[model samples]
Target: MPSSNKNLSVSVIIPVHNGGESFRRCLSSIAAAVPPPHEVIVVADGDTDGSWCVAQEYYTTVLRIPVCSGPAQARNLGARTATGDILFFVDADVTIYPDTIRQVAIAFSCEPEVAAMIGSYDDAPGAKNFLSQYKNLLHHYVHQTACEEASTFWGACGAIRREVFFAVGGFDNRYRRPTIEDIELGYRLKQAGYTIKLCKSLQVKHLKHWGVISLLRADFFYRALPWTELILRDRQPLNDLNLQLLSRLSVISIFALLGAAIASLWWTALLGGVVVFSGVLLVLNAPVYSFFVRQRGWWFALRVIPWHWLYYFYCGLAYAIGTSRHYWRQKKQLAFGN
Candidate 1:
C-alpha cells in the first residue's frame, strides 16, 4: 500500500440516459459526502428527459452525446475525461452514503495491491414494492455475503485505478447495452493479475424500482444469459458469486422438487420428494431465511419463500437458454467456416 501523505483525488463518473429526478438526487448525495470527490463527471447519453440540464446546475463537468450510446460507452468517455488517479463509477440511480468517498479513500490508501474494489447496496432500497424490494435486497445480501476476495466487478458502485483500467482497454464498447460489461472488465482485470475487493462496509442505496415482469426479464435475458455467454467465451472458472457450487446444488434441488411433483403418479413419491426438498431448502438457505426474517419479520419471511423459489426457477431457466444459445451460435459459426 502506498502510504504517501500526498492526497488521493477521487473522480466520480455517472452515466445517464433519461435518469430524471433520481439523477439529481444522486448528484446531491455526492455533493453531501463529507470528504467530497475531486471531480464529478456526468455523461448524458442522449438525454431526452432533461437530465443534462440538471447536470449543469451541479458544479460538475457534463458531457453529452447526440444519440444514446449505452452506459458502457458513456462510462468509457467519462473515464477518458477523468483527471483523477481513482475512477469511481456510480450509477445515476444510487444514493451515496456521506462517508462513502472517504471510505473509498481509506481502502485505496490501505491496500496498494488492491487494483479495484466495489461496494454493496445498503439494506435500505428506495422501492417499496415487493418485487423491487426483493430484487434489491437479494443483491445487497449476495454482495455483502460474497467472498471478500472477489473475482468480478459491479458498475453500480465500483472504483478502479485509472492506469490499470486503461491497461485492460477500459470497457469493451461493443456491448451496446449494459449487459455484462462491468463483469467482463472485472474478469479482464483478474486475468491481468490485478486484485479486486468487495468492500462490504462501503455502501450505497439503490433507487431503481423493479417491477416483477421487468425484473424477471432483465435477470433472464440481459444479465444471466449474457453473463453465461461471457463466462463460456472467456473459458473462465465459474467459482465466484452466484455460480458457486452451493448455488448450483440449490438450483438442482429446486428443479428436482418440481420434477418430483410433476411426476407424482404415486403418493409415496410425492411425499418423499416434498420432504427431501423442504429439508434441502431449509438446510442450504438458512442464512437467507434469517435475512428475510430480519428484514421483514418471520411472517413475511414465510410468505416470501414462494417468491424465492420462483427466482431460483427463473435463474435455472435462463442458464438453460444461455447454454443452448451458446452451442447453437458455435454450430452456426462452424457451418459458415468463420
Candidate 2:
C-alpha cells in the first residue's frame, strides 16, 4: 500500500521532431487528462515544422535543442529537468486517455516494487489507411497479450520511477533514433534487479500512419537489428516478452518452409512448400487474425493476412542478418585486441 504522507507526482515528457497536427493533438490530449500531470515537458529536437511554437501554445515547458537530436537524447534532457517523482514518457504521435496519468499514479502507489511500467496503443488508431490499421492493431494485440512481467519497455506510453530511471542511467543516447532505447533501459533496470510491468488497461491512441515499406524497413533495421545487438551485449534469454519459445519456433518453421519453396527446382514442390508455409503462418497467427477480425471485419483481416506473412518472412531474415553481424563484429574486435 502507498504511504499516506507521500504523494507521487508525475511529469509527462514528450519528444518532438517534425510533427505538426499530430503533435498539437497529443498536447491537447495531455492537457485534457482528468488529473493533469505535475508538469508537461516538450523537448523540441530541432523542429523545423513550427512544432515548438505549438508547444508554446499549451501550458508546457519547452526545451529547444537547435540540432536534431533523437528521441533518446530529448527524453533524457526532459528527465533531467522533471521535478516529479515519476517520469511519464509519451510520444508526440500518441493521444492518451483522460485516466492515464491517474492510473499511472495508482499503479506506482499500489505496487512499490514496480520500477517501470508500459501501456499499449488502443485498437482505434487515428490513421485510416489499411497499412496503418494493420501495424497499429498488431502492436496493440501483442502488448495487450504480453506477459505482465514484461522483459522490455515501450516509449509509446511508459513511465518509470524518477530515481530508478536515473540510477539505471536513463535511456542510452547511442540509440539516436526511436528504436530499442526504452528496451535498452528496461534491460539495465532488470540487470539492476528492478521490476518492469506491462499495464494493458492503460491505453493511448496512435496517430502515426505507417506505409508497408516503411513498416518492413523499421522491423528489419530499426527494431530487429538494434534489439538483437542489445540482447547479444546483455546476454539475456530470448524467451521473454515477444520472443517467447512458441514465437521463435513459428519463425523458424516459416523460414524453413519459405527457403524450401525458393530452392525447389520442381514447380509442384515449390507450390507445395508455399502451401505448407501459408498453413503454418496462419496457424501461428490465428489469434492475431482473430483479434483483427474482431476489431475490423473478417474482410479486413483477410486482406491483411498476406502482408502479415510477408512481414514474418522479412523479420526472420532480419534476425538472421542481425545475429550474424553481431557475432562477426565481436570476432573482429577480439581478433584486433589479440
lDDT tens digits, residue span 159-213, model 2 = 9999998988999888888788988888888889989999989899999989877
Q: Write the per-residue lDDT of candidate 1 for residues 1-338, one digit (tens) a residue.
A: 34545467899999999997889899999999999899999999998998988998988999998899888999999999999878999999999989999888878877888999999998989988877787788888888889998999889999998888998999889888767899999999999999999999989999999987788778888898888788888888577777877777788889988887877765655868977896897788888889989998898778678888787788788788888999999999999996
Number of backbone-clashing residue pairs for each candidate, in the order shown = 0, 0
Q: Which stretches of candidate 1 lie over 4 Å from their true place?
A: 1-5, 265-268
Which 10-residue span in candidate 2 carries the lowest summed lDDT? Answer: 1-10
What are the lDDT figures for the candidates, one per model?
0.87, 0.88
Residues forming the 10-long window of minimal summed lDDT in candidate 1: 1-10
Enumerate residue pairs that collide in model 2: none
lDDT for model 2, please.
0.88
